[model samples]
Target: MPLNSFKSKDNNAKPNRRDSHESTTRRVGVNPTLCRYGGDCRTKGCTFTHVNPPKDGTTKTSDCKYDVNCTRLGCHFNHPNGRLIDQKMVSLPDANQQNTASSRVVSQSPHLEKRAHQRHQQLSESELIEIIDQFLSKVEEFDTNDQESNNSDNEQVLDILEQNALQELRLQKFEFQSAINHLTAEYNSILSSTTDKKYNLLQLRRIKQKLERELKHWESRLPIYARRSDIIEKLEKNQVLILKADTGSGKSTQTVQYICDAHFIDEKQIICTQPRKLAARSLAARVAEEYGCEIGEEVS
Candidate 1:
């Protein structure tokens, strides 16, 4: 709401019987989004100009000045005298007498101004201490909130980076497992067939050697491959199995394959979830290859 809408004629004025445009009591402050000072504002009240000028052509340049007599505390447009300069106080010649520079009058006495300055300096030590304490408390609170906001932002960035890395690792694992399964199927076909036995046998030997080397290489690095039987048995007995492992532990891809091979050998309803799009596509393709079916037909 605009500040002028709630401005009272007098701070101590009583409420009228009829609905008045002015409000007697309403908590108010300058909106930061509209305030020009923003974070640099040091006053208790708004420092921006809010009034619009007349659209008529009669309005002069002098009429466009700020309302210096504004009574609101800490108002940036307040008059230098801290009060409106009454026209009556200024000296004026009579209608019969000519106005001259000698008849000019000063607005206020120098003694009154000096007295006001001394009054402000007469504050007690206790009052001074109380003011300092209040200022310090506000400063501490502002600093603490700023530090917390920065820490939260840093933590969020770290979490996103960790999730991306985990997704990439899972995709690579699926691709490697898919190649191994394809080579294994070719090796079995050669052993079971009789036509072109010599050529097929040589190719089968090479496939067997590649499969054995790949399996051994992974088994040495990943602990999950060696515990396949134990994991499968636990899954069979328990209603829900919680498999916890660090990133690149092979649990994401290998655990699903093990469960499908041991328990869901004939069941096409086995479902798996991946954290990212690429990981999901790769895992589905690899599982489909293992099952000897088109993608999304079984294990999608």
Candidate 2:
């Protein structure tokens, strides 16, 4: 017996598991001794701020009233059933065995699980209909529930649906009103800016027009002299002209008319001019075509 006691004490002194039992917590997936900045859950009020993270990393992460794995001094409690959340928080399936539960939202999921989640996410209409469907099913299954039960059940479903539909309509109306308000504000801002700029531009244009009109008045009275049709032709043939005319002068237009009239007598008139048609007979065809188009008159 003495020999066995000695051997057990020697085994107990052999290190490892004893060192593990008394250690405090650290943040998930971090070593406490290596971290200089104190990697604890002081900011978030977490339970596992003192215990070493599990080696396999399958530790449950929950903010709950009852938590067994929580190493916090006060409330490291464990629920009789594993989940701290109740059945109503999830859509529980009503079956013979009542143990089936919906797990909390988690990152990891398989194809069937993801499809189920997608169905749940898009569930506003479905959840409402399901209550009525369940009532009908219950009525069919139970013979004891009578006319009063049916009436009450139907009314309850009706009230629920009416409230839901109204809520949805109100949400849609609010969204529309917000959109209209935003668009109206944007339009009014744009209109005011354009109005201010337009007035400034109009003032500039009026100033320019007034200066141009005054310059024209001064120009009209000055008489240096323009040649007649024959004289202009003679000047062109001799390659010379002497001219001064009113700013409102047909002087520029008359030079071209002189050239055109001279053509009637000159014959073989090479109506040579600028990039513009500088003589009348030269412009006649294009003018006639435009006139025809304007009045819907056909031209061959």
Candidate 3:
């Protein structure tokens, strides 16, 4: 019968262990197929077998197309059991087992055992102390490097803060300087304006003094101004005095001014009677011109 004849016609048929063993010939020391869940598989009807393979390599089996790397669930080729493969499907040895294996290998070889004994003697003396000192120095160097890096980062942060502070100070300084300049300009303008006002006042005082002198000179030329002291003395001695004077002799104008100057009475208190309104108006106009005042002020 052909090898292909052994293939089951029913796709869902349960696998027969006896037929599989007879057809492939049970390989001694070779493990059955590993279940997908390894030793942790709980399904009672699972098709793949889970078993530990012997470590002695005493079994012979046909190689798979993909060897240990095959991933197909229905593959019929041989693959390494979990114990002979990686730690994923099997528990790894602890530190004690590794040390026992190393010690065993060392004991099995005379050359390795002699070398290990020599190395042990060297470690009991100064060579082991030197190695410890070297490790300490390397650790200290790593710590120093980390500290220096932290210090550099702190310095950079401080520099950035200082720069920001300086910029703010500069901005404040500029604002203060601008305010001071504005106030200074205003003070200077007020001072110049006050100076101009003082100059104008001084010029007006000088002009007033000069005009007073000219006014006195023009009053000296008036005909009644010559007899001003005599008229004032006569009025002081008498309650009433009638003095006759020719027209245009300053009697209507200068007489009242002399009376007001001698008595120190307000100009509005004195009254003068005239025969014609035109003459009174003419006399008031002339008196105002001579008094250096407008018509309704000192004279009228």
**Across residues 179-226, which tens digit of lDDT does each residue of candidate 2 receive?**
334433543344345456545343333222222322232222111112
Q: Write the per-residue lDDT of candidate 3 for residues 173-247, one digit (tens) a residue.
A: 343344334433543344345456545343333233223322342323334554555677887788788878644
Root-mean-square deviation of candidate 1? 35.4
CA lDDT, candidate 3, residue 94: 37
**Whole-model Cα lDDT of every candidate shown, in order:** 0.45, 0.35, 0.45
On TM-score, the stronger of 2 and 3 is 3
Q: 1-300, model 1: which lDDT tens digit per residue?
A: 653345344567433312447423211222212222222333444433222222232222111012333222222232434333223323344223332111221212445544643443454434433443453354356447645764565435566545554444344445446645566567556657777845664454345334443444343335355556668778778878888864445676567777764546575455678776656765665444344334456432
Q: Residue 222, candidate 2: how far off, in angstroms?
A: 14
TM-score of 3: 0.27
**Clashes per candidate (backbone, < 3 Å):** 0, 4, 0
lDDT of 3 at 117: 42
lDDT of 2 at 121: 35
TM-score list, all predictions: 0.28, 0.15, 0.27
- Name the 10 consecutive residues with the lowest summed lDDT in model 2: 99-108
Winner on TM-score between 1 and 2 is 1
